[model samples]
Target: MSGLRVIPTWRHGREWLYVCGEDGGTVAWYDREADRVSLLDEARGGDALEALRPFLVGSVAVGPPPVPTPAELAGLALHPDDDLAPNRPGEHLAVALDRDPGPPRRLRADPRRRALAAQQRVGEVLDGLEAAGWRVLHAVPLPGGTYVHHLVIGPGGLYALHTVPARGRRVRVADPFVTIGRAEPQPLLRRARADASRCSYALTAEVHPALVLVTPSSAVPPAPHLFTDTTLPTLARTGGHLKPADVEALHMLARDRGTWTRA
Candidate 1:
């Protein structure tokens, strides 16, 4: 499979880098020494992969932009889903468009307008993260469906799940199991901060840029090189761990964790 060879989201000494080769192949790496930035080892995955490439190849940084304020970080938080809570635990942050210093922004009612609105919601979430100081590395799709929006955020590399309910048919299957879920505002953020070493960073992710794998059950084995090398602080936020049953639908076109990857 000739494609991008990203370092499985990893960490160096005190920093993290998002490595990308050609296609969507990416990896996160960080350590104490030996830093190199540039594309290397272009080939199919697994055995054929060249082991000589350094982790930080060609500026492999992850997460969104950087800002430092809880209020600002609120922008990156997922839209209020009062329905799914405790697991998601907070309501301090909100997603909104940038301040244009003009008239009120409106979302049209046309089909294209609808798509634009959805994309805008996602953009607002990412923007909120940037304003709060988080380096959004790269977004990867989770296998199974387009609905499973899997993302790798921060330097330490954590799995973030974005469920686009409206795009359900576009990517995922019609699974009655996976429905809109939510996390407690405070606890979820607390968990995320602890995971990033108290670095409460940004909380937005680039929309469905790549596809991913959706494990039916924890016992099921995922594809090779499928997971990252980071330690998750809490499973409080959904999408960090792979449970086979959670995934029921998927999009055929998404590339990140897609099944279309030529191997």
Candidate 2:
């Protein structure tokens, strides 16, 4: 007996069974979805097969793992400190709040909190689009201390989304101007378009601009690009703009902090 054991693990919603030696080192891993077995230690192939026999539903191609793609290679080459992939929704705001929480009691709520809530609400919906071949990067910092709230790339193409906090308030849009409730109109759409333009310059690709309204009471004059939290998932249904590889490549580029310095 080779004294090998099989351990099951899950990554990105996919199941894998790993064959380990007595020393607790992984010898091989079987990906049932891909119907492949990747051998970490070629010499232990036989032991790995034996250990994985029970979990093997059928025949699987046995070999080393596939080579990383260019996008993946770039990602792997990035230093941890320079990588933005680990950033959460409203990462900049979250950090600021951590550093300076502001007054404990306030007559009015901090606008940053409202903005963060909007970003997080939209981010949750965007994250769900990954199942449909979409990738989303949140809180992408740009030059001059400005940042993109969310950058989405997928078969539908690239979008720079700016979240608007309009909870229970009516929103009216007229090109560059956006009016929320009784507050004065703001050139939010213009800002969104500018953000997309900056992203396009940074990545050398066209990036559509869109405003995401969070739980709005009602939005006036339906716009083609404007999206509400409920309708944001429809982006996954739109396709033919780019291939899967393109989406991944763009995502890889967008997740690097240095990539936005040019913007």
lDDT of each: 0.27, 0.85
lDDT of 2 by residue, 182-248 (tens): 9999999899999999999999999999999999997545676699999898898999999988988
Which lDDT tens digits does candidate 1 get at residues 167-244? 322222222222212311222222222223211122222222221222212221232222211111222233433222
Pairs that collide in candidate 2 are none
Model 1 superposed RMSD (Cα): 19.0
lDDT of 2: 0.85
TM-score of each: 0.22, 0.77
**What total of clashing residue pairs does each candidate reach?**
78, 0
What does candidate 2 score in Cα RMSD to the true structure? 6.9
